[model samples]
Target chain A: MNQTIETMLNHRSVRKFKEENLSPEQIQMIVEAAQMASTSSFIQAYSIIGVTDPEKKKKLAKLAGGQDYVSESGHFFVFCADLYRHSLIGKWENADVDDSIMSMEKFMVSVIDASLAAQNAAVAAESMGLGICYIGGLRNNLPEVSELLETPEHVIPLFGLTVGVPDQKTAVKPRMPFQSIYHENSYRHQKDTVKQEMNEYNEAISAYYHERTAGKRSDKWTEQMAKMLQRKSRMYMKEFVEGKNFAKK
Target chain B: MNQTIETMLNHRSVRKFKEENLSPEQIQMIVEAAQMASTSSFIQAYSIIGVTDPEKKKKLAKLAGGQDYVSESGHFFVFCADLYRHSLIGKWENADVDDSIMSMEKFMVSVIDASLAAQNAAVAAESMGLGICYIGGLRNNLPEVSELLETPEHVIPLFGLTVGVPDQKTAVKPRMPFQSIYHENSYRHQKDTVKQEMNEYNEAISAYYHERTAGKRSDKWTEQMAKMLQRKSRMYMKEFVEGKNFAKK
Candidate 1:
């Protein structure tokens, strides 16, 4: 009911943007808001790269599978799960911290830390009347992205956020029903109930697509998920993350 | 700054809480706000388990290394990186989605999805004059926790969010300087420059602790990090996640 909840509920990803850039003050405020998010055990293991140069943004757009919004956004921020600072601290204090840094626990912490911060940034941008899109397409080619970002060891480019003035309005996509995703105390694994919920959701999604595309396309949620998941994506992610000296324990 | 940004910026982990329960309306609104967060490629691969049973919460507290707040909060929600529903969809649609579900890319997507939603829930709770603390200690015994929750394969509980009324006030912890974590175009890996920034932050943190604890604790940020990382914690996380049918490429 409050403005904060309203902003969150009205969220949508904007792919089309106007040609105006965000003010430096807005950028600073957004990043500051991100910095205020909770960090696991005070290990603020994340960094943000603000891509302002037109040439760099263009290359990034190409890297993100030709998503032009990456180049034309008011600002593009690549959120990286970074532990290079912790590594330096280990060396400074003459402590043997390689095992911890390379452990899967630390990797998960860094990923969660980066994600929590990015959500705060998104909410901050939206609160300021700007639109933002999360660029998971960056993961389509992680090695190239890492090299382009010049990230050092133990620093992985997790995802990007493209923020700009919206040139096109988007409807908020429907999510899974509360009963489908929410459980009380313990997880309920009733297959019949789950199937019933999925059936209803599939119908809802079919109607949504039908209305959105003027009957040209009407795909159920499960149909879309099934089609997309039939093909493997980013299969090298495991090896790549391991090569970066993370989750190696 | 607007109300949403203010809610985000004022976030602090609330471990001590008043013995009060969240109303059904508050819980619904919080979860609805969470459902509105952006999902990667429309894969809403996440689930939330709300623990209202005192016995279950007590067991969870024990599982989280005796973090009593896990049991004392007004409401506790466990965010799980879930691909179980997608797997079910694959079966219903007769699609061979095993390879994709088992890939690291989908695993990362699930984790990111859950984290984003949890952060939104946190913001929503804070905006409503509530408090939240992320319980990462659940990772200490994930297998037992999973068994307790009765979650199926491909559903990994990432973390817990404890929401309640704050019983204690905590100061906002100082973070690393903006220059320390923000890069312009490319990631700045200047060792000397980073060292200088770390030195200044260490001084600030030392002073903060000195003032907060009345000289009882005056540890620098780097010192605390080095000491913490020197200990090998949660070494079994890699094998645990793999055993739970995730991140297995």
Candidate 2:
């Protein structure tokens, strides 16, 4: 009975999916599971969009870094960092919610809420024999994703997920050492010894990548990260936040 | 077997804990489960600290917005949005990490990683007949919490959680309508209609609060939020982030 929790603990990104569809009942179960997650201040500041349309999925696939799995998966969902719900509450209360409360802090709350709920949904789907992969590449063309989705003001696409039966098996990605992340009481800057720990993890990650890509990229974790840093992400995000009149002031 | 997933689907906050101690093995199981959550790029940008010392718990209780559960729970853990680990990795790689990577995006990543891991811990703890209460109030005094924990640069306390065997029961909190939080394929602004749906939820929440708090406060969700927002939270968080050299341009 408790084994599911352990399964949740051992989650890994599944990039391959079999050709089968998730039943509507299963989709409803996952959505309800997600809805049950904690919302900040009872302000449910997030939303999920499920995509079962094949044509739409193909378009989204192109938008999200050309990943075919997104289009091929049994289900696709986009999590939104939302404030329009709160905006409605503001109008009901006849209160003026300025940029202050709606700023980055609020956006953060929405993002955290959405992300947590998404994780829960992921856990549930995995428990039900579904393989899942998060499509962070949705950020690469944020405006387009927003446009395609018909997202309104005070909402932004945080990420996408593809869920289906597993078509391929993958090794668990190695993580940085516990000492690197687990701090005692407060943060210590000098815990720089984590670098040594990650050195080992880097080798592990490198080998895994080599086997996965057949040596198309020998880049280790550090190298990939360095390359990723050069690319601009959500370049107009701050402006978009302001333009949508979401709180960043 | 399917009911186990329903059990996870039935999660709610647990505030009161029986006066019993948790075994170290049980604690380890939960914390290890938390540690296994996915970290962005394997950076593992978070930390959790267990606090079992009673006097220390009492002090933290005062710091955590006077939440008595802080001291009453069988176990307490402080989840931190930490980057000190990555800083160490940078040192080992002898790589200069630009401060820009520590922007709002990265900060959100750290916070989300910690939050998701905490949620997993919460779920795991619940599976084993444990009760839990998330302590967002920990952010009521971020610097003080950080100071008390000896958290160094590049790390910040995100929240705290108290887990134990249940001594008191808390009702399942009401959620917004499915349509309100779940969209089709993009963000939608349905302020007027969502507000109407929220009016019913406000009533339900009001009823829930009245029962829990003995009708000491009004039951309207909007009113409660208004009252809560009247107070300041994280007033200095931006400055704090800047002081930590996180928002450095």
Candidate 3:
């Protein structure tokens, strides 16, 4: 395999980081890589906010549920699904585009755009021998995070990427089996087939957790997923996205 | 720059492709790379469907608005945001996870997961000297596409990826100015500042279209965006996604 595939195959989220900052050149390279990702309809409905200020990083760390890595990474970037520029374009052309921009399709487009870009940035960082972690914890308080970042309407912060030199290395977490996630020609929607595949995956994951934690924790994938899902986390996301004037339709 | 960054920066969607099918090994490698992408909380809420049957590809090409590449590519993969496995897990564990699964937060997670994995697969294919294009046109008729794929509830087809050997090379389309998309710490929300930046971009894009088409077409970015957004598209996406038992909360 080539270096690119090798880099991807060895991917892992790095939470701990060395006390060092990325050079301006590195950050620019990462952002440039993100820019090259494909955009739906060439809308490029996304933006990257580089958090360099110490105070801002500290605040974001707390806002992200007290994740110290959010403050300690070499550089933290917030990826935003932004349609503000489209709104401006509509205003300049005197076109009523609000109905289109507020539609669920556009919202999905923006989210997909931001996500594809973020993944490219992650790969770019990893290729440069750096470690990266995606901090979904930013969603814990998006309104405050948006206020702190001074984001405008039609710009929703989706997630944060923390890139830095590695302070620790961890094993790549095994994913669900290929049969479970890959279908040929059409979906294998039979429940019994899926259950058998998932049960096998559950055993593998339980073994992984057991080995990692030295028997302290060995939860099956189903048990962990059920527990997490039963809690009903992030119930405010719909209202919050609507508040930002997105997906209102 | 390294080969990985070089691969990303040189990305251009290929519509015209040489008529050659990819080997099974290539497909496996690409999907493996996709699985290596980080998932939100390890949810892995996505699946890839390899469309190989000629009849299926022909129907998909029609479903994707007569995009020839959808049928002509070396291989086409449909990336889907899936929670079917999780729903099954909940059923097995006797846990009430429907509230969480139906939340907007989980919906976003699934979409992001699918997008990230698709991007990784795209990069892997490109690194192997294959051309790749994302077909958002799959959303044109989601119900029919889902029915064709036989996807179960909680599984939404996000988009399709067509990979092949390039028959024609195209220059990379210019993106917005770096300053326009990248902000420092906080978003630069001033309308005038953004307007000025976008105006400069408009000139660049207009010139690009002019030169590329030898003056046959010269549309400014704003004009194109306004025209496209003026027409309401994909009004059925919300109802379709909700019908799939997602984002209903």
Q: Each prediction's TM-score against the native?
A: 0.99, 0.89, 0.99
Cα lDDT over the full model 3: 0.94
Q: What are the candidates' individual DockQ scores? A: 0.88, 0.47, 0.90
In model 1, chain B matches the true chain B with a TM-score of 0.98
RMSD of each: 0.9, 2.9, 0.9
lDDT of each: 0.92, 0.73, 0.94
lDDT of 3 at B50: 96
Consecutive 10-residue window with the lowest summed lDDT within model 3 chain A? A172-181
DockQ of 3: 0.90
For every candidate, how close is chain A to the native chain A in TM-score? 0.98, 0.90, 0.98
**Per-residue lDDT of A122-234 in model 2, one digit per residue for the tens?**
87888888888878778667778888888887777877878999898876665555555555444445543555566676797888888879998656776666554444454
Q: Taking the tens digit of each residue's C-alpha lDDT, what string does model 2 give over B119-157?
A: 778778887888888787776777777778888788777
lDDT of 1 by residue, A57-151 (tens): 89889988999999988999999999999998888889999999999899999999999999999999999999999999899898988888899
- Model with the higher DockQ, candidate 1 or 3: 3
